[model samples]
Each structure stands twice: as C-alpha cells, then as structure tokens.
Target: MSKKIVIIPGDGIGQEITDSAVAVLKKVSDKYNLNLEFESHPAGGTAYDLCGTPLPQTTLEAAQNADAVLFGAVGGPKWDNVEPTLRPEKAVLGLRKGLGLYANLRPIKVADALVEYSPLKEEIVKGTDVLIVRELIGGIYFGDKCESEIYEGNERAWDLENYSVPEVNRIVEFAMQAAKKRKNKVTSVDKSNVLATSRLWRRT
Candidate 1:
C-alpha cells in the first residue's frame, strides 16, 4: 500500500523549506522504491488567512487519513493579533491532539568536516551527536493559559505547566530506545529546582 503523507507548509519561511523537503522526500522515495503519496495543504496563519480557520475540516480529514504528516513551521508576527483560539500555533496543537501524537524527537549531529567551525571550543564540541526527545501534548503548551487576572491589585497574566508520570515515561522510553541505537548515552535535562513537572520528568 502506498503511504499517504499530508504536508502543511505553514507560513513565511515554512513554504520555502517544505518545498525543499518535498523534493528530498520524492527523491528518497524513488531511490528506495517506497510507494508514497504527498498532499500539500495550507495550515497555520496561511490557513486562517485563506479559510478563516487555522485547521479547516478538509485539512483535518486529509491529515487524519494520511499515514504520516510532514509539518513545516508555524507562528509569526503576522498573526499576533489573532484570537488566542485561532492563533497560528494552535494549528500544531490541533494536529497533535487530533492525531494523538505525544513524543517528539529532535536529533543533532555535527559532521567532522564542520567541527572546526564550532562555536564552542573544539574539544568540547568534538563528536557532538545527540538526540533530544520531548513530550509534546501533555506539557505546558496544553495547559491552561489566561490573561487579565488581578493579582495583589495588579493586572496579571498566567500560564500553567504540568506533566503526568505516563507522559514522562513514554518520552524517556523513546530516548532510551534511541540511545541503544546510538552511543548508548542519554542525557536528560530538567529544572527540578523550579518546576514540579521537571521533578516528575526526572523521576520518570
């Protein structure tokens, strides 16, 4: 069966980057004989501009039906004044919530050829290769955010951050699995000193 992928080339530089990504995807698919179908859709600020909604029903349906999604960047000053619910960033949250995607993986590898251009000392940056795993859906991004609350006679805004043990475990487990395939080292970073969620994250 051919795999269907929904590509949302969000806004600004996103369109340019996703275009290059599409070319790479098509090239790799051809070289590996991987049957694939890619469908492009507007999302984020672009979607809101065109359809008055960051995540339109048709885009949702296409994403839901696809085997995977290739998401470009989201959010820019252009949509800063938009309603909170319809913000460009909400498109990412919507997709993550709709698709039940929890963990996020980011890998960084410094090529030997580029090691000399290291911003840090060459010794400290040598052989710098790492994978950073993040738990997406259950973090501060999904928590309650508010504004116009009075605190001690001053107007204030607030945000909440939270994490469940299960959420932490899943991402950490993914990191562990990734470590097995790499150098068998996992460096988890958390600010247990300042956040309750970070404590739980560390324990997990």
Candidate 2:
C-alpha cells in the first residue's frame, strides 16, 4: 500500500532543508520500490499571512487524515511580534500536541567526516553517537500559569511545572528502548539539585 505523507514546509531554512529531505526520501522510495505519496501544505508565518491563522483548518484536517506528517522548523523574525498564541512557533507546537507526538528523538552523530563542525577534539568526538530522547509535551514548556501578571506596584510572573507518574514512565520507557538499541546506557539531565520537579523526575 502507498504511504501518505503530509509535508509542512514551514518557514525560513525549513523551505530549503525540507525540500532536500523530501528529495532524498523520494529517491529511497523509488530505489526500494516503496509506494509513497506526498502532499505539500503550508503552515506557520506564511500560512498566517495568507489565511490570518498560523494553522489553517484545512491543513489540520489533511494532517489528521494522513498516515504520517513530515514537519520542518517554524518561526522567523517577521512573526516574532505576533501574539504568543498566534505566533509561528505556536503552529508547530499545536501540530505536535494535535498529533500526540509527545516524545522527541534527537540523534547526535559525531562523524569523522564532519568532525570539524564541533569544537571538541577529533579524538573525543569521533565515532560518538548519542540519542537525546526528550519529553516533548510535558514539564515547564507546556505548564500552566505561564503568563505575566501585574501584582501591586511590581510585576510578577509564575509558571507551574507539573508532571504525572505516567508521563515520566512513558518517557523513560522510550529512552530505555532507544538506549537498548544502541549503547545500553541512558543519562537523564535535569536540575535535580534545585527544582522540586526535577527531584521528582530524578526519583521517578
């Protein structure tokens, strides 16, 4: 069966990189004789300019019905002043939330061919492959009370950082599975020395 892929050519470098990535995917599809169909759509700043909304209903409906979504980065200085809820970044966040893509897998490959890219010595970074599995939809980034408010003569803002056990467990499982496939090691990073939430994360 042909796989349906929805491509969102977001903003900025997104247009350049996504085009290259799609081209590579197409080559692989042809070589492997894999049935694939790609549908391109717009979101973020460009979409906002055209439709007055960063994420359009039509785009959302198509993504919801597609087998998978290939998303590029979103956000640019032009849309920087836009309201936080309507900003370009919000569109990317909205899609992640809408699709329930709660785990982010970041592969850090230190290849000899690109060792010059890093400041570290070739000996230190060479052949160093790491996968940074991050919890995408929880903790401080998606917390409530994340707004500024004026109190008395001074201005104070507070953001609540809360997480349930299930959330932690799910992320841990994802990390563990990824680690098991590679180095069989997992290193969790957080400010456990200070934040209570971090302490809970450490305990969990």
Residue-wise C-alpha lDDT for candidate 1, range 44-95, written one tens digit per residue? 9999999999998888889999998898898899999999889998899999
Output the lDDT of residue 141, model 2: 67
Query: Which lDDT tens digits does candidate 2 get at residues 66-161?
Result: 998888878889998997778887787778777778899989887678988888888899898889888888886678864577889878888788
Query: lDDT values of the candidates?
Result: 0.88, 0.86
Q: What would the C-alpha RMSD of candidate 2 be, to one decimal place? A: 2.4
Error of 1 at 76 (Å): 3.2
Worst window of 10 by summed lDDT in candidate 1:
127-136
Give residue 19's lDDT in candidate 1 (0 to 100): 93
Displacement of the residue 198 alpha carbon in candidate 1, Å? 1.9
| Residue pairs with backbone overlap in model 2 | none
